[model samples]
Target: MTVFRVGCPHCGGRAHLESGEVRLARTRSRTFYAFTCPDCGEPVRKPAGERIVELLTGNGVAEIGLAPR
Candidate 1:
């Protein structure tokens, strides 16, 4: 299984998450990848680029699309 590494700003720790632990959100202007920080349980959101979107989706990360206003 592939592990995705994300940093937690609240706890100052990096978490290694699996596909189930990560989510992809698409908005009108930008895309974001969200996950929970394993160390502090804080929610983490990061802007995702095209390459990232492709990688996450290809890796089995859940994706959600937000309605555009």
Candidate 2:
């Protein structure tokens, strides 16, 4: 399991990602993800796994670890 953090491009909001949820969804893909904006109270859907990975790694999608603190 891995954890990912996405800083919203809009409103500079923050969201966290856990294992099994891809950062983004592909066309026709049924995978679901949710993120809420802290500043705007907006809900954002992940678009694609790559997009989310880019946000975290900045280079490419890499494996993440999500162990309870």
Candidate 3:
């Protein structure tokens, strides 16, 4: 399984999650990713830049909302 390192602002903790645990969403103006923090059990969302979008999409992370171009 592919593990991704994610940070939780709530508890200041970092955890690794599988690709299925991460969600990608793209809008007309921006892209974003979201995941539940394993360590703190908090739902977190962050903006995904060009490199981030590429990284997640290339790693087989499921995307919702808008389709990638």
Model 3 regions lying over 4 Å from their true place: 66-69
lDDT of 3 at 64: 89
lDDT of 3 by residue, 2-67 (tens): 889988989999898899999999878778899998887889999999899899999989998765
Q: Backbone clashes in each candidate structure, one number apiece?
A: 0, 7, 0
Stretches of candidate 1 off by over 4 Å are none
lDDT digits (tens) for residues 1-69 of candidate 1? 678988888889987899999999988888999998989888989899999999999999989877974
Candidates in order: C-alpha RMSD to true structure: 1.2, 9.3, 3.0
Stretches of candidate 2 off by over 4 Å are 15-32, 49-69
Better of 2 and 3 by TM-score: 3
Model 2, range 1-69, lDDT digits (tens) per residue? 566666666677766655444333333434334555556777776544655545544533344333333
The TM-score of predicted model 2 comes to: 0.36
Error of 2 at 19 (Å): 4.8
Q: Worst ten-residue run, lDDT, model 1? A: 60-69
TM for candidate 1 is 0.89
Clashing pairs in 3: none
State in Å the error of residue 52, model 1: 0.7
Highest TM-score among the candidates is held by which one? 1
